[model samples]
Target: MVWGRTEEGEQVPKEARVVFQPGAVWPEADVHADSCELVIVIDGTLEDENGTYPRGTRISAQRGTSHHPRSSGGCTLRVLYPDVVEVQRPAPPVAEGGA
Candidate 1:
């Protein structure tokens, strides 16, 4: 849920609680172009290209960074999007064992 607003009168979401089911993958690619994102794994585990984040782990993604997050065994996350975010379609999955 949105918890804050910007000075320019925009409804900026300051924080969000996200629940991921088992083997769930986020559909969009989040590009933190305007602000950084702070992610806290509240329960279970969250994973991205960087690494696996377990419960109680806090990750600070700086501005201009990007990530496609997913959970292998379900998880709850407390995400803080400090400002605007650029959402892009997720990259096509790579084929296994080469063409």
Candidate 2:
């Protein structure tokens, strides 16, 4: 559950917490900018490309970084976002007279 943004107001998320069922994975792995996200494993196992994180493990993702989090045996996570609003990365410059 997210206690950051409500139905009204600034629409900025301050903090978030979630409980993942066994074999559950986050739906989106989109990159985020201008936001620092931290994930703490409360129980079970959390898996990422780097390795598998067990209980009491904490991972920090700084601004302009992204993470893909998943769990095999279920886990509880506590996340925080200093800046809830995400900034999109700028597109590459087009070539001169390119198709």
Candidate 3:
């Protein structure tokens, strides 16, 4: 859920509570060009290309950074985004030995 805006009429950023089931894979995506993202692990474990994060872990993804998040045993995360981020999905792998 997104938080309320600031008294000055500026946005207070967006927040989300995400639950990832076992074997869940979140696609790799770039952080918004003008915003950074913060993530806190609440339970279980979350893994990305950089490393694995367990409960109580805090992650800061700067603007223009990318990550592919997944969970092997389920996880809960609190994510904060400055604004709605655009996802950039990776290109599908080409099939081999076929036309």
Candidate 4:
């Protein structure tokens, strides 16, 4: 599945892990069209559809779902997206405190 690493001589994906900064996200939406996903926030915090994800938080979502994830104070995540898609959310509304 992934570039290299395979299991049982089959096309199984190898074990993988990665860390993303505040405004980063996973790409490669094509393959993720019908796959479930899992994301474990190992450290720090993140913003999602419901709210924020603190350390030790394990978030799960359905396949073909979408979300805009961001870590304001930085975070380290262990993510497993059976497939990956880039979900974009609208920017936050500007403050009315004048420029």
Candidate 5:
């Protein structure tokens, strides 16, 4: 459960999202952007080259930082985003003169 939810119990803007995908791991995969983000294991286990994160573990990742999140033995987590980012621009730009 996210304590960062709004009064309506909906996700607030810039709210951190905790992904609780059991038995899911992406080796050497860093996903995210230039925003405040953190990955914490509310229940289960997770680890990367940096260190091993067990249950009740919290990790802090600043802006512009990236890490490969890997979970062993499956887990659930609480991700906190101090700031939310609006993905405003696409990676590739549209044709210059197209309306």
Candidate 6:
């Protein structure tokens, strides 16, 4: 679901306050070729490819990248998306499993 809308009443490229219950995970990853995203863990733990991010941790997903966010013990997150799309594609494979 789209989060808060702008003063102009648009949901695209919006800011969101999301809550993940214990063991909850976001099924679809976010993908945008021209937009980056910012994720801030407000409480509990959030895990992703980079590793587990504890409360107060901040993460940024670069443009053309994607990630599935999961929380083992619940979490609150503040996120900024340039544009939240209906479809999310997996991130491109790495080179030789590195980077």
Q: In model 6, which runs have C-alpha deviations exceeding 4 angstroms?
A: 1-13, 82-99
Model 4 CA lDDT for position 79? 66
The regions of model 1 sitting more than 4 angstroms off are 6-9, 83-99
Candidate 5 lDDT, tens digit per residue, 3-49? Answer: 34433445444544455466676755564453557776877788777
Candidate 4, residues 1-99: lDDT per residue as tens digits?
232212223243322355667666545332333456677888888676678888998887786667777666778877675553333346999889867
lDDT of 2 by residue, 22-67 (tens): 9898788736554677888888889977799999999888777766
Across residues 1-99, which tens digit of lDDT does each residue of candidate 6 receive?
454333355445457788999999788875645457888898888997769999999998887787778888999998877544433446998779546
Candidate that beats the other on lDDT, 5 or 6, i.e. the better one: 6
Best by lDDT: 1
Query: Top TM-score: which candidate number?
Result: 1
Off by over 4 Å in 5: 1-13, 16-23, 85-99
- Write candidate 3's Cα lDDT for 34-91 as tens digits: 4578999999999988999999999999877888899999999998876443343479
Which model, 1 or 6, shows the larger lDDT?
1
- In candidate 1, position 65 carries an lDDT of 86
**TM-score of decoy 1:** 0.73
Compared with the true structure, the alpha-carbon lDDT of candidate 3 equals: 0.79
Off by over 4 Å in 3: 3-13, 28-30, 82-99
**Regarding TM-score, does 4 or 6 come out ahead?**
6
Each model's lDDT: 0.84, 0.74, 0.79, 0.60, 0.64, 0.75
Single out the weakest 10-residue window by summed lDDT for candidate 1: 81-90
Tell how far residue 38 is off in model 4, in angstroms. Answer: 0.9
- Decide which is better by TM-score, 2 or 5: 2
TM-score of every candidate: 0.73, 0.68, 0.67, 0.55, 0.59, 0.66
lDDT of 3 at 34: 47
RMSD of 3: 14.7
Arrange candidates by lDDT, descending. Answer: 1, 3, 6, 2, 5, 4
- Off by more than 4 A, model 4: 1-15, 22-32, 82-99
